[model samples]
Each structure stands twice: as structure tokens, then as C-alpha cells.
Target: MPPKVQQKSKEQKMAAAMAGGKGKKKKWSKGKSRDKVDNKVLFSKEQFDRFHAEVPKMKLITVSAVVEKLKLNGGLARRALRDLEAEGKIKPVLISRSQRIYTRNVAEGDDE
Candidate 1:
């Protein structure tokens, strides 16, 4: 006598899949929906100049503020802030794990 094996039905297979058969599904966070910026993308001289001009008026600047002001995405705003900092146009006032606040760098004679 031979023994017969039973095959799983589609419903059973789907249930198994939902019940931890695979790794967790990717979660959609608020920040995750923002477009990612390309590292190779650099700002134009004109754009940098505009930011530089406007930065002094802002006592405190953040990535979100830049995004709103320049109409840039989250990632691009972050990169722009970093670039400004690197160029000595802006100085970081506060640095946190997820966010940074910057203020315009005062020129040597500007304050006098």
C-alpha cells in the first residue's frame, strides 16, 4: 500500500504567508515618503548666492525651513544646508541626531 500526500490550498498558502512566513513588510513613515537626493547633484552658483543672501535674515534655519523657502525636497534641503555650512555661509547653532539648526555666519566687519 502507498501513502498519499495532500497539497496546500491557495487560501492556506496565503494564510501561512501572512502569519510570519516571510520577513516584515516595509513600513511607510512620514519622512520615508520624501524623495531622496542624489549625492552627485550640486547647487548652481546662483542658487547658492540666493541662499546666502536670504540666510542672514533668518535667525534660525532648518532643513524644513529651507525646503519651504526654496521649494526643495527634504533630501535636497539637507544637502543645501550642508553645502552652505561647508562654504562658510552658514554656521550650525545646534546639531542633533536627526536635525540641525543653523544661522548665517557674520562677516568680520559686518557686525561693526
Candidate 2:
């Protein structure tokens, strides 16, 4: 007696590919291309100022915390901090392994 043969439909083949059970996705033919999306944007000075003002109040805030508070993206938040540090406006106070702490340079009049 011979063993039975099985046939799979096109939909089944596609399903397997979609589920990653098959190898890598098939590449587009020559002359075909995909568009790349860019998610980074330059942050404005106003946003940086807002971050600076808020820094004195927060004993410590991570990068994600600033992003959520300012309603800005991660890139913008990072750029703002970098610029502030470059201009001697703010200082970085490193916390544990993955945490970054920030504090403002208290001005002469800010105490009173």
C-alpha cells in the first residue's frame, strides 16, 4: 500500500507565511520598493523652555517621564536636554543603571 498525499490551498500557504512559520517574507521583484517612515522631528525652543522650567520642581525624571509630561516624542525630549546641557542651562544627574536625573541651575533670584 502507498502513503496518502496531501494538497494545500493558496490561502493556507499565505496563512503560514503570515504566521512566520515559513522563512523570511518574499522580497519585491526588481524595480519595486517600499517607503521608509521617519518618526523624528526637531523640537522648538518653547518646548525646551518648558522642560527647563519644570526641571527645578522634579527631584528626578526619566527620559520617558519628560516625554509623557511635555506630550513630545522621545527624540525631541532627548534633543532638548542635550541642547540645554550644551548651553550650561541644565545638568544631568545620573541615577541607577537606566535612569537619568536632571536638575536646573538655581539662579540667584530663584531662592527668594
Candidate 3:
């Protein structure tokens, strides 16, 4: 006679998946939104201008550049940049799978 295989409950299945079936927790941490910002309260005009002032002469700046210049975490800066882009204050020049390049909108003769 053949031996019968045991079936697992929902809880036990979840435990097994979480243990090693999913390829470890570190890989999933990158996709989590730990420092999300409220879109309703984003600063458009004033804050956008100030943020640009920090890097006026540059042709293009990455999200990480803004983060380092503004002393904000990478995720927070990325969120703020997205909000600014949606507001039409800045435009995305180039977008890669991992990073985005943004250009500030300034007057024709404006320098610095």
C-alpha cells in the first residue's frame, strides 16, 4: 500500500511560503512604501521654485541628486519629484527603469 500525503492548512502554507519559498524578505523590502507622502499637501509653486533654486544651472538632475542636495531620503525625494512633475513645474527629460532625470522650467533669460 502507498502512504498518503498530508495536506497543509492555509496558515501552514503561508508560513512555508514566508520561510523560504519566496526567496527571502530582503528582496521584497525595496518595493515597500515606508515613507509615503500625502499627495494632497504637496507644495507646488513656492516649494517647487525653492527646490529648483538649489540646482538652477544644471541641465538635468536625477531624483537622487535632489535627494542629496535637499538632504532628504531617496524615497521621499522621489515622491516629491513625482508630485512636482504632475503639477507641471518640472518636466522629465529622461526616465530609466531605476531612475528619473528632471529639468527645471525657467524663464528664457534667467540665469542662476
Candidate No. with top lDDT: 1
Over 1-112, each residue of candidate 2 has an lDDT whose tens digit, in order, gives 8887888999988898888757978897699677754433655688657777885456555677777687777767776677766777666778466566666655623453
Task: Compose the digit string of candidate 1's lDDT tens values, residues 25-90.
Answer: 889766656575543235578766776688655778998887667656677778778887897777
**Candidate ranking (lDDT, best to worst):** 1, 3, 2
Task: Please list the C-alpha lDDT of all candidates, in the order they appear.
Answer: 0.75, 0.68, 0.68
TM-score, predicted candidate 3 vs. hidden true structure: 0.45
lDDT per residue as tens, model 3, 2-110: 8999999999988988888576555444565667543323545765677756654456767667765665566767887787678766778888898798887665454
The residue pairs that clash in candidate 3, if any, are none
How do all the candidates rank in terms of TM-score, highest first? 1, 2, 3
Instruction: Candidate 2: count the clashes.
Output: 0
Model 2 scores a TM of 0.46
Model 2 root-mean-square deviation = 11.8
Candidate 2 least-lDDT 10 residues = 103-112
Q: Cα RMSD (Å) per model?
A: 8.7, 11.8, 12.1
